[model samples]
Target chain A: MRQSSSTTDEKEIRETVAIILQNFSPLKENLIPILQSVQSAVGYIPQPAMKQVASFLAVPAGEVFGVATFYNQFRLIPPGKHPVKVCLGTACHVKGGNIILEEWKRRLGIDEGGVTQDREFSLDRVACVGCCALAPVVLVEEEVFGTMSPSAVEGILLRIRIEKERRSGCGGNEE
Target chain B: MKTITLTIDEKTVEATEGEMLLWVALDNDIYIPNLCALKARPLPDANCRLCWVDIEGRSAPVTACNEPVYNGMVVKTGTERVVRLQQTALELILSTHPVDCGRCGKNKRCELQKIARHLRTKLKQKRLRDISKRLPIDSSHSLFSYDPNKCVLCGRCIWVCKEEQKVGTLHFAYRGFAMVVTAFGGAPLGEADCTMCGRCVEVCPVGSLIFKNAEK
Candidate 1:
C-alpha cells in the first residue's frame, strides 16, 4: 500500500513538474527560473522535481542540487504551516541572533531546514532581513518579531498557540 | 589555436595564444604555484590567489591562472612582491587548513605541501591565526572518506564531479567562511546518487577526500 501510494505521489509530481517546465526552454540560463516556478508551484523543490529539471536542462543532477543549495532563497525542505526565518545579519549577529536561533532549535528539537513532528513550525536562517535597526529579528509567518531574544521564543510560541486557539474556536484544536 | 612565444622567468616558451599563462609555464618546466587551475576549467576560479606573476607593463602582479599567453608577453614568476603575495595567500589557506601532515592521507602527495616547498615557506605558517573548520569525517562511502576540516575549498573536486564526470554530486554550498562542498540536499556520499566513481576523491588536492584503502 505504501509503495503504491508513493508511486502515485511520484506520478503527480512528474505531471506537475512537466506542466511547470513546459514554458521553460532547455537553456542553462532558464535553470533558475524553472526552479523558482517549480518551488512556487510545489511549495518546495522535491528531489524528484529537481531530477526532472536536471534532465530537462541536460545538466548533471548534482550541479542542479549545488545551485539549489548555494543560494539561501531556495529551499529543499517543505515549509511548515508556520514558517520562521531568523535573521543573522551583521547587526543581528552582534545582538545575539545566534542565541535566539539556538533557543528555537532547542524548543523545537529540530535543526535549521527542519519541520516539527506536528508540522506546525519550520526553522531557517537568512543572511540579512534589512532590519538592522531591529537587530536579532525573526519572522513567524506574516508577523515580524524584532529585538528577539532567547527568552522571548516561548512567548512567541505561546502567542502562536493563543492565535491558533482563537482561530479554531478553543475546542477545534486538538492536543 | 595560434602558437605564441612568451617569456616566463627569462625562459622563452611556445604555447597556444589563448592558453592560460599558468599552464604554459608548467608545460615548459616553469613552475608557478597553483591550487585551483584544472585543465578542464578554462575560466580560472582564481579562488586560491597563490599563482601571482609579474607581467611587464603591468604595475601590480596578476594571477598566472587568469592571465592568458600572448606573443612577446613577459612574466616574472618570482619577484619580491610576487613572493610576498604568494606567501600571504598560502598563510591564509594554511590558517583554515588543519596542518597535521604527519597523520594526513595526502601527506607527501598534497598540493599544499608541494606549493609550500616550491615557495620555500613553512607549512605551519605562524603569521595568521588558525581558524580550521573541524567538521566530522564522512566515512559513509565505502570507497572513500571525506574530512571537511582538511579541505582547502580549491573547487577541483567540484569541477571534476560536476563538469568533467557530469555527476554534479558534490558542489559548493553556503557563503563566506560557512561555505562547504556538500552533496545534493546536504546528503552523505553514500546516500546521494553518487555512482561511486571516485573522481571527487581523485581530484581533491588535500586530505579532504581519500580512498578508504589509502586512509591511515
Candidate 2:
C-alpha cells in the first residue's frame, strides 16, 4: 500500500511538472522561472522535480542543483506549517541576535536550517528581512516579532503550542 | 578588436577595447589578485571580490574581472581603499575556511594565502568569528577528494564542470552558511555520472578539490 501511494505521488509530481513546462520553452534561460514555478506549485523544490527539470532543459542535474543552491531563495525541504526565521543581519547581530537564535534552537530542539521531528516547525536564519529597524527579530510565518529576547522566544513557542491546542479542542489542562 | 590604451598604476598599457581589465593587466605582466578568473573562460564569475581596482571616475572600486577596458581610463590596481576591500573579502573567505594550511595539499601554492600575504592581512581570522560548518570530506571519487572545509566557494570548479567540460558533476548546494558544492541529488561523487575529469581539480584555487594520486 505504501509503495503504491508513493507511485501515485510521483505521478502527481510528473503531471504538475508537465503542466508547468508546457508554458515555457525548454531553454537554458528558462531554468530559473521553471524552478520558481515548481517551487510555487509544490511549496519546495523536491529532488524529483530537479531531475525532471534537468532532463527537460537538457542540462546536467548537477548544473541545475548548483544554480538553485547559489541563490538564497531556494528551499530543498518542505517547510513546516509554521516556519520560523531568525534575522542574523549586521544590525540584528549587534542586538544579541545569536542569543535569541540559541533560545529558538534549544526550545525547538533543532539546529539552524532544520525541521522539528513533529514537522510542526522549521527554523532558518536569514541574512536580512529588510526590517533592520526591528533588530533581533523573529518571523513566525508572516508575523514579525521584534526586539526579541531569550525569554520572549519561549513565550512565542508556548503561545503557538497553546493556540494549536485550542484550535484542536485540546487544552493544556486536559489529561 | 581595436586596441586601446589605459593607465594602470600610472603605467600606460595597450589592450583590446572590449578586453577585461583583469586579463589585459595579466597579459601585460601586471598582477591582479583574483580567484574565479580563467584565461580560457572569457566570461567572469565576479563571485570573488578580491580583484577590486580603483577607476578614476567610479565612486567605488570595481572588480577587475568585470570591468571592460576603455581608452584613456586611469586605473589604480592597488590603493589604500582597494587594499582594504581586498583584505576584508579575504578575511571573510578565511573565516569559514579551515586554517590548517600546514597540512593542506595546496599549502604554499594556495592563492588565498598568496593574496593574504600580498595585502598584509593577518591570518588569525579575528575580524569575523569562525562559523565553519565542518562538513564531512568526500573522498568517494577515485580520481579526487573534495573537502568542503577547505573550499573558498570561488565558483571556479562549478564553472569548469558546467561550462568548460559540460560534465556538470559538481554543483552548489544549500545557501548562506550552509552552502556547499556537492554532486547532484547529494549523491556521492564516485557514484554520480562523473567521468573522472580532473578539470575541476585543476581549476580549483585552493586544496578543497585535489587529485587523489597527487604527491602529498
Candidate 3:
C-alpha cells in the first residue's frame, strides 16, 4: 500500500472525525463501534481521527491508534477506487483462496495487502466475509465471486482495467 | 422515536422506539434464530448470523441482530436465503467448536445444541478439527471451568464479563475465525485478576465456559 504523509489535510481529517462522532456517541465501550464507523467513513483511518476518538472515548490516543492499527482489518492508506478482498478464512484457505490471492498479486503487480502503484486496485485479505459456502471467495467492490481460479483472475483484472480506461475516456484494449 | 411495521413469517408485526428486527420477531413469536444475542445486552455485533433474515431493501441477508427496523419492511425470517445464511453461520461456528457437547454438562441446555436441533443441521460439511492444539482449560477455579475450544466467538462472555461484573479480564484475543475470548496476556482464568464472578458462565449461551460445580 502507498503511504501518505503523516500530516494529513486538516479539513479532511475534521470531516472524518465528524463522521465518526455522528455514528457513535461518547459512551464508554463505544470504542469498537467508533473505530469501525471511522474506518467506514474514511476509506482508511487517519491519525487525527484516532486522537479525536481517544478524547471522545477518554482512552489514550496512542491506545486508540494502536488498536486501530493492531487489527489487520484497519488500513492506514487510502484504498484504491476498487477494493479487492480475498478471503483467507479456514474453509477458503483450505479451498485454495490463498492461491487466488497470489494470482491477484501477480496480475496487479503488487503484494497481497498492498495497492498497485497506479492506485487502480488495492488488495487485502479478510478472515471471512461469512461466505465460506462459496469457498475460495474473492470480493471485488462488494460483489462476491466464488471459486475463483488463477485463470479467472486475469479476466477480472482485465475487466477492472477496461473500466479504468473507460473512465479516463481512453478506448478499450489500450492495456 | 420512529416505528416500523415488518412482516415476520408472513405475520405483520410492529416495532416501536428503535427495536432490532430480531427482538421484534421474537416478540411476535416469529423465530429468528440467534446465539450471540442475549436479552440483557442487545448489540447487533452481527457476529452470529443465526438471526439472519431476508429484507426486501437489502441486497444480502441482513442480520436481524444488527439491522434496525424500517417502516414497511418486508422481512422473511425463514426463507431459503435466511436458512442458507443461518445454516452457514451456525455451521461455521460449530466447525471450530469442540464436538463433546454430548458429554458436556450443558448438553441439552447448550444453545449450540439447541440451534442444531432446531435447524435440523447435520455436520455434513467439512470442518477444522484440530483438537491436538487445545487452549488449556482452567478448571482450578471453584466457580467454573474455562474451555476455549467450545467457544464460538459469540462475545457473550466478554459482554457479560465486562458489562455485568465490571471485569474486563476477558476479551476477544484474536481476529476473525481465530478469535478466542481470553484473559489479558493469555493468563488462565483463575490466575487472572478476575473476581471469580460467574456472570460469564451465567451469560454464556454455549458450554464453552461453564460452571464446574454443575458438571457431573
Clashing pairs in 3: none
Residue A112, model 1: Cα distance from true site in angstroms: 5.6
- Residue range A1-175, candidate 3, lDDT tens digits: 1235434555677777776587677876888787777778777777667768877887545446446655887887778767899999999999999899999888888887688887768999999889889899999988899988889998887887777767675543332
Candidates 2 and 3, the one with greater DockQ: 2
| lDDT winner, 2 or 3 | 2
Clashing pairs in 1: A62-B168
Best of the two (1, 3) by TM-score: 1
Cα lDDT, all candidates: 0.88, 0.87, 0.76
lDDT of 2 by residue, A47-156 (tens): 88889999999988877887777766777887777889999999999998999899989999998878898878889899888898989899998899999999998889
Off by over 4 Å in 2: A28-33, A36-43, A67-75, A78-175
Interface RMSD computed for candidate 3 is what? Answer: 6.6
Taking all chains together, each candidate's TM-score versus the true structure is 0.81, 0.75, 0.55
**Higher lDDT: candidate 1 or 2?**
1
CA lDDT for candidate 2: 0.87
Q: What TM-score would chain B receive for each of the candidates shown?
A: 0.97, 0.96, 0.88
Worst 10 residues of 1 chain B by lDDT: B184-193
By lDDT, rank the candidates, best first.
1, 2, 3
